[model samples]
Target: MGIRPLAKARTSFAATFGGLPSGFWWLWTAQLINRACGFVMPLLAFYITEELDRSAAFAGTVVAGIGVGSLVAGPFGGALGDRFGHKPTLVAALGATAASMIALAYARSPWALIVGAFVVGVTNNATRPAHNALIADVIPGKDQVRAYSLNFWAINVGYSIAMLSVGLVSFTGYTALFWLNGATTLIGAVMIATRVPGRARPAEPTEAEEAAGGFGAVLRDRSFVAFVGAQFLVLTILLQSESGLPIAMSLDGFSPSTFGQVAALNGIVIVAVQLPLTRLYKRFPESWVLAGSSATVGIGYSVLLLGDSAWIYGVSIVVWTLGEIGNTPTSFALVARISPDHLRGRYQGLYQVAWTGSAVVAPLVGGWVIHTWGAGPLWIGCLVVALAAAVAQLGIGTRLTRRVATKDPEEQPEPAKSAPASDAG
Candidate 1:
């Protein structure tokens, strides 16, 4: 059969699916579904502590298992994305994640739970580098920041809906939450496998580029390395919002439901504010934006030390959410800008590692600090980390902006004469 016209194909596809560039929709939908499924983590501590009769320390260990899996899988996942392609790897990882979630629902023994958490972590981390690299491949340079911002907004929307829905599932049972989580992951997998276009490989790598060593080259770049360290610290502080906040709430006489509200507030603020402010901030240098955001987040967390009241906690959430919105997209844009086209997957994967590695260790350390010393010490430590990250990012961001500015304007690729009219099969 003769191939249909691209425009006709796009029109039909848009009519059926509500958009074309199936790639963009696919990525956004996958994020939405994956995040919706991920809403279970906040509840997982409750399930293990209240339902399964596990200790706080043990529950923290279980949660950390996911991070461990992610760290283990991250580099290899990025390499796979570079070697093969993002679409297939993402589909397979999502499928694996779904299975892991289902297994987690059924887990009775601690070992089973740990294994399930690890699998989920690994698959979850693996999906990100591939997803990010694919976006770099498909989206134009000027549009990339907005695209990542939109993706972040979609994630929060999904998370907000999931948090709201979790109350209904609690009535059914905790296992039901796991099942729902698994189903959502499956939906993401299906969407990506069927709809997302695969990334096109570049013609070839130059000898110098190849000899410099793929991901190794990225690691070797001094400024990039600093940026990664800054990212690590930023995540170290942010992860506390997930692991430390609940403990702080409990110590102040709040119940599990109240803790859930606090968590939901984090998502709600991100969803409500991220898109509106993204455009406003886009004009600023990314370095200033990142430093300002990190400082904002640090200030927010520091404010938590002032009191344990619900309103105080709520205010803290709002502050951190704003900082989060400011930092996330800009950071990703910087990474996309610095990476060579052929090694984008590898760099994205490495970026995932910085965040994931922190996620694994930060909670364990934060939990221990809270258990042994006090919330004050933990929050104080977080503030210090944030300040350090801001400082490091200032330097990194300055270097990145300078690199972009100094590049020969004539050597830059000419803008595409016209937008590729349609993203159709």
Candidate 2:
């Protein structure tokens, strides 16, 4: 933690970015645009409730519809990525997402909003897996962790900017915010389609690879199944913050602004910590890191049960963010490592299906729990869920590590190689 060591860590992170493949910068650009637009959800919800004259409950249902659309789209998107290639899929998804956002902006009725949400959800959810599969195709194995971390960092930065912009502009009109969101998505689509080079699919995989059968075959792998399950639970715990934490914090006398600040802090922490930690953990066993991260998140939420003050809650956010930084990139890297080359998109889609499915359920359930029980009970319930996920991680950690270690070396990309530095602007 000394200045010298911190400087070294920073240098390492900087160097890793310097080494990313050519297409990565385009992917990063698209991610930034997508995430900046992503920050409009809170404003979107506000617009639905205040301007559209929808009840809060109805708005929540529309949001849940978005999740359902994403869940339904994931596997198909993954399959499409595997078949048609990542760049084409990314372009199509982004274009559709932008169009859907425009339609959503004009939606007048609750059903219309739901339909728009579903359209947006299906398109947007496809973007991630396609983008990730492209990265997995281009980047070296050792560099994948840094690539994912940088991607997340870009996302959080875009999110922070978008959130700030929405706050500033929504005073004018939420429709304006919606317009801006759509514009950004369109820009992202254009960037990916024109700027990023499409990854070349490996010369058609042999009969064995074909037999691997996309996500369906991937799902049958016991270790992969367990890993996906653990990821599902982690997402369930994370979604509670969006759905349950606000209600819980309101009950504890925290203002809406305070909740926003805490959530922003979570993003900032991830942006700050993810790269350095990814480097630090690169040499560690992925499974152990995942298990420990899960345990940390459970501990953090449990600590929230003891807190009534803003400072205490802030500390809990830090703890949970640390856990997030530790878990997410490693989990993604594992997926990339284990999946068949042709099926990376399919696997990522399946993984995202787990995530979106949890989003669909966690909010409704968390909201119901808050409405029925209270803050204390809700926090305890989240803690239990986190711990359960941790236990699941513990059960599968050894098996996953073994699977990773025993994999044929030829399946992985070469050791990390430095790319030529970008032109100094």
Candidate 3:
């Protein structure tokens, strides 16, 4: 291409992706690698029912174990990141999770599987707080939204790889899938340990922070706490797509392979459109963006109640994919708006806790509700929760802005000292 053409392209790229640190890109690369190898979760239900001869309820319980691990670990992990350093916590979480994935691959007994699941959950998701905090530490405020958007985009791209490949791998056996996931997890761990310096720990908290007391302080922030509750409800509704939707497809006589194709639609759409959508949401209030997203997600799931055809499912996927595109980056930016830099990890963890808890409860609740009551009621309940959360989000904007306005001047939102070079996809 001509030099002028190349120059134009680079300019466009920079506009879409605000300058973020090289460290953020390294973290993004690690996320891409790790999620690309994630094979077990999406097909876990099928594995349990077909290979292990277990009920959907059993599968739900196993999956719920992951949530239990994350629930316990998230905030604590965040605290560790703040106290000890983000890098070490990330390395340890990845290592432990790698071991858990291997154990899960080999386990045959229910108890073994459940224990494995719990360990995987604990180790697997514990990195979230540290990882998120590190991003905040590295990236500038002006670019935080795009930075998070790109990160979320990379994740779905990895999921697209997993979704497209895992079903094909199933014929060779799940043992291969589990081992591959472990290998990648370990690789991602090594990447961060060596490439991202985790040597710098935060200085001791100021007297105010010391008195407020970490988790106690995070809990007492009423606006943030309310936002967490809203997020928790929305997540409980949306996570059903991951846990229950595939199972319902299976029960309807769709093979795992077929279901994989249909389910991949979500990731495909995300990979295609999330960046453009991210740009669009940047123009609106985070609150309105979030509320609209929650409602759209509910509408997407409710569509599932209408029919089971490939086309119907495809339409539903598009609706919710748009919601997913908006919810995550906006939520991260919102969190940053109200959080003190020193307490960012704890705040991220509290946010992590909200959604991770949904993963724990949604599957078990969704599975049983689906098992006893049927898919229709489950969809209805999901829609109801989604709408309620949407309403709650509208209130969040008011509270979040109020808190932002009243925080200590030094604690208030400020532009990053400077931004990194912008880049497009």
Question: Evaluated with TM-score, which candidate comes out highest?
Answer: 2
Name the runs in model 3 displaced over 4 angstroms: 1-10, 42-62, 103-113, 167-177, 197-199, 243-258, 304-309, 364-381, 402-425
Across 1-425, the per-residue lDDT of candidate 3 in tens digits comes to: 59999998788678776466677788899999998988877777778888889999999888778768878888878888877777788888899888889888888899999988888887887888888877777775556778888988888889877767876664778778888889999999998887875447755678977888788888988888999998988888778886778778877788877876887788788888888788777666567778889999888888988898877877888898788788888798778657876677789889998787887677888889889988888888878888999999977865675565466334333322331212100
**What are the models' TM-scores?**
0.82, 0.88, 0.83
- In model 3, which range of ten residues has the least summed lDDT? 416-425
lDDT of 1 by residue, 136-212 (tens): 66666666677788788887887777766777654878887788778888898898777777754443578988788
Clashes of 3: 5
The whole-model lDDT of each prediction reads 0.77, 0.76, 0.79
What is candidate 1's CA lDDT for residue 305?
Answer: 90
Instruction: Supply the TM-score for candidate 3.
Output: 0.83
Evaluated at residue 98, the lDDT of candidate 3 is 88
Most lDDT-accurate candidate: 3
Which residue pairs does candidate 2 place in steric collision? none
Residue 45 lDDT, candidate 2, scale 0-100: 67
Question: Can you tell me which runs of candidate 2 are displaced by over 4 Å?
Answer: 1-10, 170-172, 200-203, 368-374, 408-425
